[model samples]
Target: MKVPFNSKDREVCIIGLGYVGLTLAVVMAEAGFKVTGVERNNHINDLVNSGKAHFLEIGLDARLEQQVKNGNLKSVISIDEVESASVYIITVGTPLVNNSKTTNLEAIKLVSEGVAKRLKADDIVILRSTVKIGVSRNVVKPLLDEAGVEYKLAFCPERTLEGKALAELVSLPQVVGGLDDASTMRASDIFGFLTPTIIRVTTLETAEIIKLINNTQRDLMFAFANEIAGYCDVVGISAREVINSANIGYPRSSLALPGPVGGPCLEKDPYILSEGIKALKGNPALALLGRTVNEELPKVTIENIQLLLDKKVTSQEKLKFTIAGLAFKGRPETSDLRGTLAIPIIDEIKRILPNVEIFGYDPACSNEEISSLGITPCGNLEDVFKDSSVLLFQNNNPAFEKLNLNSLSRLMRQNGIIYDLWSQFDGTSLELSNGVRYGGHGLMYLYNK
Candidate 1:
């Protein structure tokens, strides 16, 4: 029998209250279901119960507070508090293992063991974490079966963007697959409350691969853009202008902009996809190559900066390099620094110019956090611009969008170089009084001059 969509008896227990899990829990609670969030981290559990979010997400705080006030949502450190729920959704992180490309299932295994202990007949169990292919069937299902409890198991991978989770959760079509027919129906019925569209697939592996391919394809598109940008650099052409003109009035061209492509999902998903392909004794040459191209972008950026420095600067020891914006992305806006390209860029710069003074600043990140990454964090934007010979805008933060170019230009030394990686400024028209040179990715006209 299919469970009713808005049945009051169907309580939800969302495991792992991270970005994916917390957003889903809040939305589910807002949809009029009693929700319990199970988290292993004490700090996260406390933050959720106190009506605050540990990380930044657009419109998450107010909704979370409302859900807490209405008694629709509660967070706990143990899964024992989740025993009463009719549906269990696992959204734990499945990061790559240390120094290896293999998918680490330790968190999933631990959560599965906990869920298995409390397994009850007819209870719906959904895996929403991004995982390697067959993880839902091979890794998660076996744990539940060993407990000798009857439950419906399904894989419904998370596909929402980090900053737009709540909005995308309701608007985007959810892909759901299950171990059996009844399991699929139960999983679909539960997610139906969040969104009207639920795409039902035949098996668990399909759902897992669907999410993997979604991100991997995106990674490949970005890699292609970056690759083209590199080629444009060699030929003295603007990649941005070329892409924009090509995409104009064209439905076939959906090219992404070239920049540092780093985040929790894009940086790691391709590797996971390639690993899955390798496990099946198949070659994932294209996927691996795409990952290589994206990963090498930071180094390419560093090399371009070095060329500018060698031509403009008289002494390398006096050069102060300032990097602005540390977050992975800035459009939707978030404080998440996981797999941020800024770190690698900084590391590569330090390797190339060991004596150059490097400073970093970001509106979303803290001084302590930046210091933890071995970057000397600036207290203010002026401090970053002061005495800086090279300013690199790494993140696409909105704060950087409304910048007073004249005021900032006045602060920097003469002939100071500005590398706008995201094309935040007009490379063709920027005329600073202090002779500050501005160049962006694919804007070879500025570099050629």
Candidate 2:
């Protein structure tokens, strides 16, 4: 099979049209590449053909629809499309599963096998999937070698924020690396259309390591913030206020406050890296510690509830809990809940209070999605606020911040625990409420209503 690296529109084949894949495909097409999005599932293709997007990213669906109309983007199912592209980018999922510490990179592996089988000497297979440090070099390259295909391969991990992927694709500096010098140069040239600032790494392993380190470092920072927040709760100080005030002069030290560390990348990728390393080195510091701290957030969150409920709960009253916002992050309304941070918190809530009726609410997700997790979904914002003992803010949705404190107090069951996970609440208003307990990172303020 001849590699399609000819001059005709620099044909690009992107495998997997999930959140990352679909966004990257649209970005490439808009940048004047003839893009063919290949997905194993036909559902995504149907959505694309119908001018709809499966996931929510800012202006992504409209951009994709425009590209499709302009005759620059096309969708297909067969792996035979691999033979029709100059560059094949594998943008598949790498999710962490139950009973396994490591992530399942089966999609990446399958795509690599297909690419290796169809690759020619001058072809490039760019892996845009987030994987462990040595995956590209140790796993992918070996598969290519076994298939008797000589080609350039690069590890170019996607670091685009979900809501702002299109802008970030052009602005964010991309880290790319390949097996050889020629491979690295080719990968850099191919991605030049997406972003001008490209940092080329020496080895494939180094490039892969760059992706892992980015998430692991962020995880470490968040873990530190969460740990410090607990200490702030004991000391009777407002953590968010202190951090916000101190952030004025000490710019470098200020990072995002501790919230749910779910989402796809931060929760899963670090374990893949740490688990791979632990197999060889026995113990890793930041990666393992970060995972432990992040996983423990739900339990820690539930403990905060107990602290608030101290001497308040009587035998007669039943706790009515409401969870606000279920998306992994705020903006553009995505439905991908691979490594959801809210799950642990939900699990803890269920385990501790079996009698409590937990109701979850998200603007983006449906009842079917929440029901799959064994939880009942409250239809809307008003439904969640009506007569609840506690309101847990799992995600930082901007819509939740606009809520009326007085109106919410009326909906509560007297002395309700207002668990502000992202601390998106007014301290003054919370303090004014009678029998309302408001707690967030480092500062737990109880309102005697």
Candidate 3:
């Protein structure tokens, strides 16, 4: 693709300062564009204005502060800024509707409505959020028509991991689709600053489906990993070890270690795709099944704990458990617990053992944040282990790797269970410590053998 516009001089306006929008805006500003971030909430506005990031991204705050101080980035709570921007990108939330496959695109609609009203001729509106396939024409373009504006429209869904978003934005190739050739040209030109390897689809629907398919594929793979873990549990085999050993021969088919696949995008995108298929009068059983398996993992992981502890029933007040890592992914050290698998597992714990004194200790989580979720904030690792009857490890953090068996053994009560979600410690060492009981997705293989 050939660049048509002056990519370096483009004034980029991003709507919604969320994990997606905020990162895109910062990266654009860093890429030498005059970036204007339009936010609706007062709290988000305050954070951005103060040069502080609302969510966790690797080095996002320092980069945002540097760009803001350099006069390259500025945020405002207004749609009026659209008049100055030649490119408008939408990166709002598309939440799931409880157990249902449908998505709530209210944020997308509102942004489309607001951006449509402020559209000028030749200005390109790019939908960066994942939505139903027909959103570009059935929703966005109609709003622009209703506003009586002659503008270009495109869908260039976000394709970056939470922790590596900044690096991937500049390194990964982008998928773009526009209403017309002219629209595609304009979007391609602007995005070329970030990556020149752009794949243009024949229709906006294709672009929308492409993004959905990418996440759907990952969701399915994670589900397979979980099912394999289930089999490993039954056969007394370590699924992680088996997977690792298998990778030595057929390296291409290696899936991520079995864990909860919870995060805003991963958990929601597959449902949206499934819902779209349902609307088209097709049975999306496989997609729905993948979602079910992943969502059920946290509960299943907890169930594995019950069997290991050999406790039929327990009170919450007497039980103290700790979740090691909080962020969905392993890097960038995020504080975003939204749709995090830990939320559901913790909720299940409360339901079964209402009196269990649940203690959450994540280096990324603040006391106020954990308190808001009705959990006691244990700021230190030692506190997490102090007299706890049970310890639950939700994520993988290097801090958990530093603990010695002697240190862990002294922290628990007699015959106390250690629920290791990420296999935080050496299973053999933990089991040999005498008082400690080790349980995880596939820990049975190490000791059961």
Per-candidate Cα lDDT values, in order, are: 0.86, 0.77, 0.78
lDDT by residue (tens digit), candidate 3, 382-429: 888777777777777566677775766677676667767666566764
Clash-forming residue pairs, model 1: none
What stretches of model 3 exceed 4 Å from their correct place?
Answer: 1-9, 81-83, 311-317, 431-434, 445-449
lDDT of 1: 0.86
The TM-score values for the models, in the order shown, are 0.96, 0.92, 0.93
lDDT of 1 at 376: 90
lDDT of 1 by residue, 1-449 (tens): 32355684468899999999999999988888788999889989999998999888877889999999999899998998764887889999989885997899999999999999888777778999989888888899999887687889999989998899999999899999999998998888778888989999999999999988888899999889988887888788888987888899999999888888889899899889888888999888777777899889788888888888778766744688899998888878888889899889988998887778888898888888788778799999888788888899998899888887767887887778889888877777766747778886776567667
Error in Å for residue 290 of model 1: 1.4
Task: State the lDDT of candidate 2 residue by residue for 1-449, as single tens digits.
Answer: 12234554388899888888888888888888888888878888889866678876758778989989987788888778544776888888887766887778777778888877777767788888888767887787887776675778888989887778888988999888988998899988878877879899898878877778888888888887787777777777777876777677885776558777878888777887887777667566767688788788888888778666665755445677888877787554566666776677778888877668788887777788877766788987887877787788888777877888666676677677777878887675554254666766566743322
Compute the lDDT of residue 185 as modeled in candidate 3: 79
lDDT at position 420, candidate 3: 74
lDDT of 1 at 198: 95
Among the numbered candidates, top TM-score falls to 1
Query: All predictions: root-mean-square deviation over Cα?
Result: 2.1, 3.2, 2.6
Evaluation by TM-score, superior candidate among 2 and 3:
3
Q: By TM-score, is 1 or 3 better?
A: 1
Clashing pairs in 2: 415-435, 434-448, 434-449, 435-448, 435-449
